[model samples]
Target chain A: MDVLVYIEHLNGKIADVSFELLGKGRELANALGGKLDAALIDANSDLATQLGSADHVVCAVDASFAQFSPMAYKNALAAMVKERAPRVVLIGNTSMGMDLAAGVSAATGIPLIAYANHIAVRDGAVVATAMVYGGKLFAEAEPEGEQVIISALAGSFSADAGKGEGAPIVEIFAAPTGGAGTQFKQLIQPEAADVDITKQDILVSVGRGIQNADNLEVVQELADALGGALSASRPVVDNGWLPKARQVGKSGVSVKPKLYFAVGISGAPEHIEGMKDAATIIAINSDPNAPIFEVADYGIAADLFDIVPALTERIKSG
Target chain B: MNVVVCMRQVPDLVEELEINDAGNDLNREYLKYVVNEFDEWALEQALLLKEAHGGTVTAIGLDLPEMDNALFTALAKGADAAKKIEGDFANGVSSHTAAKLFAGALQAMPYDLILTGVQSAEDLDGQVGVLLATYLGLPHVTVVTGVEVSGIQATVRKEYAGGMMSEFTVSLPAVLGIQAAKQAPRYAPVSKVRAMMKEKKIEGLSSSDGAASSGIKVRRMFKPEGGQRAEMIEGDADAIAERVVSILKERGLVK
Candidate 1:
């Protein structure tokens, strides 16, 4: 049986999260000894080519797929699974993925597992690591069924080396019609500067230690040198030194990057839970005993003002 | 510009959540409930919206008999009015159920916009906004950190992974799951706190006849356990690099 993976997009470009699911879906597909088909609701065929490769691409582009209508998406996905008869459907942990996964699983009367930090196949069953205890705990569950719905968290999946002998075979299928159950009467948006923070590999994150709003420029200078974006702690956002858009906490966005430099960050549980996963975490704080160092790959117990500008100048001059 | 902000009374997040009975449920012996920190921020978002656009902020939640203190917490956090669905619905009125209950409550006097935190502190499901939208039949957007409201609609900037921002605009009478979004949450003013004490306009919604059981059932809650065998890399930068390379090879996380 074929496994379906949900692909999320923004203005025609497949979201980076969709690819992450693909990266994990490939592993699960190989483990289950089945074909992997990526599902794009209201998307085009060229996305399959741009995606590099997939066993198959299911398109559900209709007037209904134009906007994210959860009811409509669930209807479309459930119908697809019935027709294709896939064993496991993979989805990202993002909004569309979370929304579609739950609804799809529930509507089809199949067990749905989500935010699967990790999943390993063994003993004729899929042991999926799902988040519990509010991102603090992980559980390995094996849903007793021929078909399973699962996902891998963002940044956990690495890009495939494409190491296997043959590349992924591409197959295209049409999305069958189901009652478009959901409707999007309107789109409400928040007011803020819209910038792409995902493309940058380097991020300079500051926490409560900055003390004042003016100190932000010190962090910004380094971010500029490295072509990275500036993010901050919850206090900074709370005080309006930076917008909530820049905040890095569990309640905010989870950032995974090649290098994240944390300045003045105390490394609280949830805040650390969000950013400590960065490939390289360089923490510079006055308190040598700050908890941020516990998870930092590189720890500098120095005044950030002295260290930040020097680092920026060094990188610039180099 | 009236808005209904949904809040949850959850275990204090700073306190370590351990399964005292050796299963999924938290031990109430050491537990004290506070408004889910993010949902507090969501109520803060509603207050800010009301302050700017001029409207009423109604706070809604399901409170146990022991949780009358939660009503004050919501009121102190700047909800103009408060409503509690009295029942034990931790599992029954799940996130989806909460959304459905709100939808049913709002069908009569739907707010111009409904605001929620991206996820509750306890459940952290992050699904209610979209689920509520599906039932309310309104447009839904999540991870919102910034908002600009016009008549009957608003524009929002949402946070994507890696701290990126995506902008979308939707008409009002819709559902929005707000993030901190840089609209600094206002602290409780002495006057506002004083006024909230006397200003009592709380309401209770009926969750009978399957309103509590309209969604999926969680069969069991499993305990989490794992330990990583660390391969520490300590030396000069060069030596550490070599050790890291070897470790990566061993773990198969790298080539």
Candidate 2:
């Protein structure tokens, strides 16, 4: 195998981003005429067995690898990379992925390209594409050396179940010790969302332009009238205006509701990827050129303040 | 305590940006520059730490024409000192090179903690702080939202996906990739910044050794591939609301 994908697991379940990378890694491996391999640290054997996309699965099931200790993962992966010498390694551009990728890249002196949206093997080297200028532009990077590791952005690629007939060859690798500088204390999950926005059929999403916490009532009224849940962009959640669970974006809930009303959301690429799968997306923003409008099914260039109340009234009366 | 904040002047993407004719980089001639957003948060964290712990916060950036204003603004916002590296960091391809530049500059300074943004808006790599930690041989954490220093070890809260948070007790002389400040970054008015510009001097450090060339190279940069155009809706408030209601009905979203 000449290409390796790190399988990320959280809360005893495989992360969706890991499967997305596997799909992408399978493509890159095919492009290079190499087998695809998956790396899992402290992952369940059953989870590794299901990664049919990979030709082989390497599991470091040490107790130390149970939780995400950057040094522990870095040391283990670095050891594997040292032994495997794969041409390219792919990781998800998530919290764990970023930490692991950076540590391994630094430890092994391998070049790393982060937030890669696309990857291709050209002339025997991985050509990774990443977004820049806050997703307004794209740049293709080619690592100057034989080895390259990239963190592919979440939602950039679709996850696919690859066709592999036989059980993948699972190699159990021993985890390395000697990480004393940092320790994993605990994982504090957000309190269960009062309303799981993912299950809602309709989502009324607000963004920074919602202005203030007091103004949320107007948007909520629309959501209430439509019999939908109220959601928000990162700013609204970060501002403590909304619970984190009601946030929609790459880092928030991925909602594919029947109708998504984006009120005042400028639609950053991160935010767009979350609800881009909505059956109907209606964006109301004051900025005519907001990127949300570009992806919206129906984009109205007006202040959401005026539109939300009017929309709420109409939904109630009509 | 001495704290260093890695600051960067990035192209203000709110303004229009054009790819240079070379096809691999931005056209610098027309783009306006401002402090990278996350780096501003990192600076605020550093300032807040200085306020609470009675330490000096020194901000450093690559020597760019527009960085003087950013450093001066930081000074007005309570940064104790500022420094700019002398080199062509614009052409640097990866965080590795930038981290090397920073490491080279910091080798002589005594510091208890170093901070930088989790990532840059332009590169979005989130690699600099980690790489800097590696080069400096220090413990490091990324995407940190909260920080508290008690003696030598600091307890920090790191944010993960799905709103998960992890608390870590990292030893001092560490690097943190600050995701956000405990509070919003303080606003420094242009007049206050101008006053600081007259009162402060950003120490210039020559990177004569030059940043080691990065292994990552840009092949090309272009706009995203085209997709279907969105349908624009035009009308007054009531008219648009009606349109939305009708569309919802058409989609069976409303009875």
Candidate 3:
């Protein structure tokens, strides 16, 4: 049996997620006692060797692949899948991961079991567990055949997984391409910013009800006292009251800080889904029925207008 | 300045709705729907752009009954035409899927640019614009806060953490997820509501129950428990406010 994992990267280096995928793939490969392979399609050869732990690293390299060209990347991986006929494939559930997973699944007409946090083969079929309903429910999926496709949810396993293991096995394979289907005219990169919220330990996010520009100073004071990152909801960013970089919902960054505070947010499910994994949550809102309270470890029923400044002063003094 | 605005109607998220207990299909009875809040911005931006540019504005929606109000408003705002497509909603389609669908509908009739909300009020994946570009194979600039069209390429400003903004250039046929007020959405005239209702028709088509197509299936429903109580800070309204602030500070919420 063969299980193929899709390798992902940014600028030729393996993405953090690829390691996580390897960890999950390792378990599945060991379980099936099957060879684990990876599709490493990139311009650089170094990343291919690093990801070589795969019993077979299906290498598809070309100059155009320094950055992801959807058509080229998909074509290469599809060719590998067609050739190998692997029983299952695993990918990470990130932006790139989701796109490739969907595209590949559609092309192959294979069922996609995405966002799987756990998986086990029960009596031969691949059974996967995925959290659904905004991390509110877990679905147990057992595909009927040996063939399956899955994208592992991020942060599912301990960081320890990256620490273990032998050097990746390496192999080279042919890629499918005529290059006629899709061509990237240009690749305009967003300006690089130093704020990587994923690396932050704490994120203090402000919402709309802060009452205007002056209250923002108080939020600033609080963030300084915590010596942590400060972020905002879409409204705060949209209103020109906060910078777009600070927006913390799906459009912004998906963060898992050690502590997250929701200040006056009504707790849209979209926003909550992005942050519910924070180690601790405290919600402050004037509305007694604010949805943020539903997920907060501690809730405050008071106007943010009144509380923000006071909190800032207290923290400064403390 | 030919501009295309996109909007989608979605199930109201605030409601405590459920999937039909009897099956995986939606429990439409308890569901309330809306003009997908952010999509409103996309529609508004289109109408505003058309007013500024000489070209006609056409609004396309994955036709649904509830979108009639929104489509008519788009027309009243002077959209030359409104095209509706019945699309499969259960699929976890990528913005790539949208580009595939939209590119086909738009090939014969193309625009200088297309705008969408940063994220849908429901799915909020924040990847639509990026995905669409991949499918249509156009260059895209996203997380945009401001834009200007010069020749066929666009110069756009994007905001980042710490109040930083950066500008990038994207060529035409690009998909952008517009932030609210990048350009203020014009208010629809009160008098036009009735005419819009008469003139607008929403179009819709459902794909097969492809909920599990993405391999991301919903197996069961679970709601987080929330019973821990908040102890109000003791004092008068003003004093109480002060106390709560201190609590927030104590909790590292605010300064």
- Which candidate number has the best TM-score? 2
How well does candidate 2 score on lDDT at residue A55?
Answer: 86
* Candidate 2 chain A worst ten-residue window by lDDT: A158-167
lDDT of 3 by residue, A196-275 (tens): 76678777788877867668877776677767778877678666776556667544666788778678787754466467
Better of 1 and 3 by TM-score: 3
**Per-residue lDDT of A241 in model 3:** 79
Chain B, per-candidate TM-score: 0.76, 0.92, 0.75
B74-177: candidate 3 lDDT, tens digit per residue: 77777777766566444334333444566556555568887776555333122345445544555554445666666767666544323344455566767766
Q: Per TM-score, what order, best first? A: 2, 3, 1
Write one digit per residue (lDDT tens) for candidate 1, span B16-121. Answer: 5556455535555666666656676787778778778897888777764334455665678766677776656543235546666766777766578888776664
Best by DockQ: 2
Superior candidate under TM-score, 2 versus 3: 2
Tens digit of per-residue lDDT, candidate 1, span A20-101: 6676667777888887787877644555665544577777767656655554666777778877878778777665565566
Q: What CAPRI grade goes to candidate 2?
A: medium
**Where does the lowest 10-residue lDDT sum fall in candidate 1 chain A?**
A159-168
